[model samples]
Target: MIRLEALAKRFPPERQALQGIDLEIENNAWVLISGGSGCGKTTLLHLIMGLDQPSQGKVFLHHQHLGRLSAQARARLRANIGLIFQEPHLLQRRTLWENVAFPLELAGQFGRALRQRALESLEQLGLGARATALPAQLSSTERQLACVARALITGPSLILADEPLERLDPQNAALVTDLLRARHRAGGLTIVQTCSESPATLPDATARYTLCAGRLVPSGLLER
Candidate 1:
């Protein structure tokens, strides 16, 4: 579903975030990428999502080159991807339902269909009763669960999450992990980057890789 070929990203003042990174994620596969801080995990994800352009090389999403696509085309392509960040990044002014429905609303879904889709996603995460609450009103775990619900509401074919479970308690972290695994099993390509090598996140992964000094290297085979 996604491929990165010799991808490299360099920031101003000669800071290289990634160098010679090649990756491939097939449909329905769960890939785990682990790395320390400043190791370019988030930068790599941004390149794959077309949020950032690589200084060298190419990123292909569903066979289309991201760097070569027009802005409108990129936006359209991005609709097929769901991204969950370390922080939920929910809007303070928007209620939980509104935040989860934001993506569908952008796609022009409205009324019953939009509401139902958002509600269904929240229900899946056990957040149905909190739909009317604001982000600040919810607990940290609830906020993260709400983010997962928002990401899945679009039924995206690919999911790119960066340290999604970093701030959750053990119970909440397990819940999020299970949700991600279930989504991948349902045919979505899921790639997650975590700083720590937690068994909850690694056991079910089809493959694993590590980022070190801006390079992508095989970590080892996962048990699943």
Candidate 2:
């Protein structure tokens, strides 16, 4: 489970980015956090991911307090998570398959099995033919899909996606949505995604919340 207790953040010169945000997310649940830009959605995700510290309150993942974890320990903890950034930060010098296999490589998996797994992930994202292509060679949509492929290759139990559908056209956005839904339905995957505007066909979230001016407001359940 993921829990946040009175979470808050402030930037230099007293710019409040988040305030008194309390939330809990159960395992295998899909949660959507929606808001306009500068509403602290990304900041919340960062705190949850242990990429940033909260000025007040605490963040717990699987009952482990993130603030107390040492940097090395936090790095170890993050190995279990799949993070999809708003920008597809692909390695310009690496092939798509190589990029997807990166996490596995970090965990010491190599050889034919690694190659096979990477290719399979790319295939699942409909980028099989572009597996050997460089990030610069692919279109924006393909790069984003490639980022998705990399994130899922590790089969993480929790997925943190920041504006995942932002740059895609409707067709590609639907494709990405369907892929995430399939994984969530397959069981054992908890997805927490942020968006400026929720998609029309977004799957019913286990819970939906909106952030405004650094405060989290429950948006209630979405109807099918």
Reference-based lDDT, each prediction: 0.82, 0.90
Candidate 2 TM-score, C-alpha based:
0.95
lDDT of 1 by residue, 49-79 (tens): 7888899999998899999998889988877
Model 1, residue 13: displacement in angstroms? 0.8
Could you estimate the TM-score for every candidate?
A: 0.91, 0.95
| Deviating ranges (above 4 Å) for candidate 2 | 222-224
- Superposition-based RMSD of candidate 2 using all C-alpha atoms, in angstroms: 1.5
lDDT of 2 by residue, 1-224 (tens): 89999999999998999999999998988888999988888899999999999999999998999999998998888877898988889999999999999989988899999999999988887889999999999998899999998888999999999999898887888888888998998999999999997555566578788898899898887653
lDDT of 2 at 159: 96
**Residue 135 lDDT, candidate 1, scale 0-100:** 96
